[model samples]
Target: MALGLFWATVCLCVFVAVLSLDIMGFFSRGNKFQVEGRTVILTGGSYGMGKEVAKLLSQRGANLIIVARNVDKLKAAIEYAKSHAKNPSTQRFHYISADVCSEAENERLLKEATEWNNGKIPEIVWANAGSSTPMMWLESSIETQKQQMDMNYWATAYLAHKTLKAWLYPQTPYSPREKSAKAEAPRHFIMTSSAICFYSFTGYNPYGPAKWAMRGLCDGLRQEVLLYNGARRSTKKTGQEPAPFDINIQMVFPGNMKTPGHELENLTKPPITFILEKDDPEQTELAAATAAIKGLEAGNYYTSTNWLCDVMRISALGGNPRDNIIKDTVGQWLTSIVWLFVGPDLDGKVWNWGKKEGMPELKPEKRIAR
Candidate 1:
C-alpha cells in the first residue's frame, strides 16, 4: 500500500509540473525579440557565431551593420548578410572595419552606425567580438591575460557604456510630443559570454575570469535598466521626457561552438584541458546562433545555447533574473545536488592527471627569467 501511494504521489507531482509549464507557455506566446525594420549593430560579425547571427537578423528584415577588424572578411560578411535579407530592396547592409578592443574604435563604430541610420541609434547592439588564449595560470604570460581581458571584457563594457549613454541620454532629448507620437519597441543590448563563466576548469585561467566579469556587468546592468525603465513610465509626475524606449539587457552563454575562433583557441589549449572538456558537445555556428535568437525571442535574459550550458547557467545564476521561476528553482536545486558530486569528481581528475603526467613543462620561450 505504501509503495503504491509513493508512486501515485510521484505521478501527481509530475503531472502538476507539466501542467504548470504548459500554462506558462500559453502566456508567453508572442515573440519578444521582434526586429523587423530595425537597425542593428553587430560586432565580430565577420566570422563565427556573429556572422551566423547577422545572417539570421537579415532574414528577419533588420538593417545590419557588421563590424570587424579584417576588411576583407567584413566585406564578405556584409555581402552574405545582404544576400539573405528578407526584403532585398528595402533592407540595407553595411560593414565597418575596426578593432573593437580599442575604446575609441567602439565609440566611433556606434557613432558611424548612428550616422548611417539617419541619426537614430540602432535598436539592437550585440557585442560578440572576443578571443581566448587558454593556458594554466602561471604558464600564461601577463600580456596574454591583459589581451584576453581587453577583448572579452573591456570591449563589451566600452560598447555597452557608449550605447546605453546614447540611448538613455541622447544629445537632443526626446520631446514629450515625440515620446507620445510613437510607441517604440524595447531596445536590446546583448553581450556574448562563454559557458566557462559558470564553471571553469584547468587551462582557462586567463579566459574564464574575463567571461565571468561580463556576467557581472550584465547582471548589474539588468538591474540598473529597471530604474531607467521605471522613470520612463513616470514621466508625467517627473515632467521629464523619458528615454525613447525601454532597454533590454541580455547575455548569451554559448559552449563549444565550431568556428574559426574555436580552431584558433584549440591551437593554444593545453592537453589536460582537452581531457577535461572532451565530452562537451560542440555546435555548429548556425546552431548556436539559432538557439541564442530563440532564447532572445522567448524573453530570456541569460540565454544558454545548449542543455549543458543551461545547467551551468542555473547552477551559477547568482543575482540574475530567472526566465521561468519555478523551472529555474527546481533546476537550481537539482544542479546544486549534482554539483556536490561533480565538483569532487572534477578535482579528482585534475589530481590524477598531475600524478599520471607529472608537472606540465613550459616551452623555453614561455619561461620567465629567473
Candidate 2:
C-alpha cells in the first residue's frame, strides 16, 4: 500500500542520515592531535623551541632522541630531557650528532636510532632542524641564497623523506616489536613548516623562497599520502589492514621569535666572513641583543607568555587573513596557490612559538646567566 511504502522510505532516510553522521564523526575524530608515550626524534633539539618541545614530551612520558651538529649541546639537551622527564624510568633519551643539512648524516641518524632502540623505531620524527639567514634582499650573493636554500629547505625536505622512507616504510629493516606494532597500528609523520610559507615579507630575501619550497613539499607529501590511503581503502582486499601511515604536516607561521644563537663563536667572528658588516656600535645592537634574549626567556612573540600555545589556540579557533592586494597577487600569481590560500589558516594553526605579543620582562631566574 502507498502508506506502507512512505513509512519504509522515512526509516531508510533516517538510517542513511545516521550513517552519514557517524562517517563524518569518524574522520573528524581521527584528525584530533594527541602526544603521549610515542618515541620522538627531534632535530635542532639542542636549542630554541625544539629543546622545550622535547622537554615537554619527556614530561608526558615520551621517549626522545635529539639530533644537532653540536655534540656538547646535544649531550646537554639529552641531560635536560632526562632531568625534566616525569617518569625517567620509562623514558628513553638519546642524542645523535649530525648536521641535518647533510643527507648522509640524516640517513645515519635514522638508521642508528632505529638500530639503537633495539628496533623500537621512533613513532614521530620532528624535522625542526633549521638555521635562518640574515634578513636581506635577494640581491645578496648566490652563495648566501644557496646556503639559505640548503640549510632551510633542502635540509628539511631531505630529512623528512629519509624519516618517512627509512623508518616508516615496511620493507626497510624493521624491529620485531615495530613489525608487530605495525601489524596492529600505523604511524604518523609531522613537519614544522612556517607560516611564511603562505605570505611574503619585505625582508625575507632568499629565505622566503626556501620556506615556499617547504610548503610545497608538505602539500605534495600530504596529497601523496592521501592518495595512497584512499587507494588502500578502496581496494576490495579485506584481511589485515596495511600499516596506517598518515602524514600530519603543519606549517607553523610563528611571527618573529627571539631564538638563541646556535654557534656563538661563529657569530662572534668577523663580519667579513659572512660577506656583511656588523651593525654600527652606536646603533641599537645591544638593545636588539638584549630584547632577543629577554623575548626567549619570556617565551612571547608579542606579549603572550607562550607564543606557540597562542598560535595553536588561534589556529583551533578559525580566523581570517588581511586581504592585502599586493601580497595576495604575489601569493596567487608567483607561487603555489594552495599554500597561499592555506598559509593564513596554517599561520596560527599549529603553534606560533615565536614572538607575537610583546615579550615579557625577564626575572633573574629566567635571565640567561653570564
Which candidate should be chosen as best, given lDDT against the real structure? 1
- TM-scores, each model vs. reference: 0.91, 0.61
The Cα RMSD of model 2 versus the native structure comes to 13.7
For residues 240-340, what per-residue lDDT tens digits would candidate 2 score against the true structure? 44455554443333333445542432333222323221221221222332332232223222211233322322332222221222323333344444445
> How high is the CA lDDT of each candidate model?
0.87, 0.56
- Candidate 1 lDDT (Cα, whole model)? 0.87
- In model 2, where do residues sit more than 4 Å from their true spots? 1-31, 174-186, 231-234, 237-241, 262-370
Cα lDDT tens digits, model 1, 1-370, are 9999999999989868786876568657689999999999999899999999999999999999999998989999999989999999999888888888999898888888887887778899999999878767887878878988999999999999999988877763321123454658999999999999999899899899999999999999999999989886673666455685799999999999888778777777778889888898999999999999999999999999998999999999766688977668778999999999989988888999999999778762142211
Give every collision pair in model 1.
Answer: none
- Backbone collision tally, model 1: 0
Candidate 1 regions with alpha-carbon error over 4 angstroms: 1-25, 172-181, 235-240, 364-370
